[model samples]
Target: MPDAASTRAAPTASTASSTTLAIGFEGSANKISVGVARADGTILANPRETYVTPPGTGFLPRETAKHHRDVVVELARRALEEAKASMRDVDAVCFTRGPGMGAPLTTAAACARTLALLFDKPLVGVNHCVAHIEMGRLVTGARDPVVLYASGGNTQVIAYNERRYRIFGETIDIAVGNMLDRFARVCGLSNDPAPGYNIEQEAKKGTKFIEGPYGVKGMDVNLSGILTFYETYAKEHLGAGEVTVADLCMSMQETVFSMLVEITERAMAHTNAKDVLIVGGVGCNLRLQEMMAIMASERGGKLYGLDEDGRMDDRFCIDNGAMIAYTGLLQYENGETTPLEKTWCTQRFRTDEVLVTWRSEAVKRPASCEPPTV
Candidate 1:
């Protein structure tokens, strides 16, 4: 893996402006994403490819690492090509450095370091969770909002405080997506190309609710019982008539999203933040968004769902490199860039490590003109 400390001497002002490109890499879980974005948070190109690990499998660090090594270059090349740029045009490379599988994280870091060295560019390390929040902020322009992040690896309610992003509530066990995926597999839904998508589609046809675990206690969550119950029910009752998959899907979505809504509402109340932003892959669920909107509206708060682009923009919902690149640019502008010697990867990094609000004194110059970097 690449060492985060090696710094390329600061480029001349002209060179910096001419080649100021931000590349974001996300190689966590099953997806390997690479995106290029401009300093103004405009996404140049977002390209990602998903890898499928076997079902009922826990985190296999070594296997994931190998997957990254095999696909990072291809994904990066595709992203650059889509952006209509080359290595020479890039000034900085940003990658998800931690809070993920060590093997995959190292693989991505190694590739990023090699590219930085080859192109003589600065390397920026980013937190995956922060990238999700930054994406919401950039897309929706929500400032100082309560963030609800629900994904395969994380489920938390976060608020910005004293320059850092703090977690007020989170899952005590598996993530919401993880639970869904596991349940899907148990229900024999993994045979579909996209099990989650399939489940969502089936859930739309479901009008009845079956008994399932409802373990929402305060701001914290417990999903193990729900998952276990689903597993046993699927085993014993899958062959029974009138037990449609749609009912199961509907029940699961309602139960989990209701829990999420409760926690997000509590976070908003606790923080006194009127703006509530939902992020992470699970944020794409329309039912979840509807519930959140209703909850926020009832509390006399506004809910920003980041749907300006479209109602079903899968590109933005899933983890992407563009979010990481844009976030790195924000940190860089704010003088939050960590020294090469002090930068390190953390598999369990808390979002509080990086300050939430960073102001950049650097003035924006025309694309044709050079801007000074301080």
Candidate 2:
């Protein structure tokens, strides 16, 4: 049932069936990933290769692209091996084409084009942000969800509307994941394993919630200003004992995730959707999930986290090829595909820019799900 606050009908999926087998290539940023999936929601194989920069340094487009070009073929092969499937089983080749680092996206697209030519498969160009949202829906089983996408390069509150997933709110500057990773670098943390996970773990010991600038303008959130304030504090007071690192980390998560939840809740109210799905890299944060759950419960809504049995923090949370594969399969079912000549990657693709012809007005909820307890 739709929330009383909203009279919108939940999207109902078509019962029609088709071959869902798709192989996706994702190299939007520092990670290169490949995924194979079936229409029945079975993930056959998902493989990823990451580029690690030195401590205190951020990822560069050139370096990231070089890394992807070097390993993409091998990674794709490995993914196939893991799935126990071959090129003959794949129905289409999909790749992330936009709203990411240009160099990496181009690398992935070029490789995808090559694969499409070789395998004689249909080529599908996927929007990076939409991939995140669709992947969340698949893995979490959240029907008609109000999506909150938070990653290194994006922060958006999205809802499925007439033929599109419309953005209700977004960041004006840096994204939430970028803000966290940059701060981790400022705090002298290595970008080897992960940054946000390290910060979340450290924040568990924080006793005081350091007050920082909480930025929210209408439905959007601004982390740039608050990040600058924290950076200054880190330079001056972090070493001077004025504030502990834990304090900053804890407070940062609290402030930013709260802003995200607030905007997502607003989208929920506007859309009348009772299910909130948190997607992207920052969506793996337990702190963010906890805060979102609290907000959703207050409004008699349920919060769905795409942890996928706890793999989201590492595999599903970050940019991955499987998401592209899954979303591409959805698009393919809607008679959508790109020609080889049209497979250009982009660095700025907005969420509302694409037409969603895949879903219908068959109101539904998460299967086997109950309403959140107050």
Candidate 3:
């Protein structure tokens, strides 16, 4: 966990072709990543590894930390090599600072600090949620869009305002990804690649629509009760062939994603926003993207969830180091750095806590003049 403060002295400006380069580390959960990026939002190299547990189990903090420590150094070397750059080319070191598991966050923070001190470069601590939003905006060419931020430990509808990415709506209980993972364990789904991916594949084959809890409490959503009901129903009906796992998966996805879309649409309407941007691990879901695209089109707006190549690229969509590096590059250009003494990690960091001083004021667009689709 690193401090999200700007109290440190600025490093010498890099005159390397008028663009600054940065290396970033990310081990917030089971994923460990290292990436290099330029201040102009160009990703030089981004590589990551995931620490997955076997079926019927979830990853724990201690083992996940060990995995990160074992592979992070190698990944960093690979990233720098892929970028065809050395320590001299890197202007700053950045890492995910908080709102994640403590042990994993510590591993990334320690790696980032070592790199920064060894190279005598500035250190920047980036917010994981903010990194996602910044990367989404950069890649999609979407300006001032309402963001739907969804992941394993977080669920929120966010929009940039004043000097912060404000959280307009969020989950009151468990994140949608967490609920899906827990249900996957109960159904004995494989975690080799990811539980959510397996569930999504199974859901595609499903046809029956089983009734489940729709937990929408005003602008917030509650998914814990829905997970409980699905777990109990599976135990009673799965063994008797009364319901299939695919049906349960499909039904649960529909129920929960509907809740997300509902809140995100409300945020868009409240803000009069014409574009919607989806960012997070769960944003990789094609079904979710389709649903969001439909909602955006119906409102005479566009959805910014796909890459420039017109598909979900996991390197930017999932938790990766490039997002951290790119965001840190932005902050550094704005004359912000985290002091060495304050570069400690925390697990309770909030999304709205960071001060985003890089961007100008958000511009509102007329509904008839929406930006071209990405």
Highest TM-score model number: 3
RMSD of 1: 8.6
> Cα-based RMSD of the predictions, in order?
8.6, 7.3, 6.6
Write model 3 residue lDDT over 14-69, tens digit each, in one string. Answer: 22223688999988999999888887677888888999999999999999999999
Residue 61 of model 3: what lDDT?
Answer: 98
Compare the candidates by lDDT and give the number of the best one.
Answer: 3
Q: Which of the two candidates, 2 or 3, achieves a greater lDDT against the reference?
A: 3
Ranking by lDDT: 3, 2, 1
> What lDDT score is found at residue 307 in candidate 3?
49
Write model 2 residue lDDT over 119-197, tens digit each, in one string. Answer: 8999999999998887777766677789889888899998876667778899988999899999998887778766887
Runs in model 3 with CA error above 4 Å? 1-18, 307-310, 362-374
Return the number of clashes found in candidate 3: 4
Candidate 3: C-alpha lDDT: 0.85
> What lDDT score is found at residue 228 in candidate 1?
91
| TM-score, cand. 1 | 0.85
**How do the residues 1-374 of candidate 1 rate in per-residue lDDT, one tens digit apiece?**
11111112211112123235688888767677888876665677777766665554444678767777788898898888878889888767888877777777777777877888788778888999988887777666666678898887889998765446778899998988888887777766652345566677788998778888788877799998998987787678768866777888898888888999888888777766667888887777778888888888888877875356534345666777787877776666555554455446668977766655453223222342221232
Give the C-alpha miss distance for residue 37 in model 1, angstroms.
Answer: 0.9
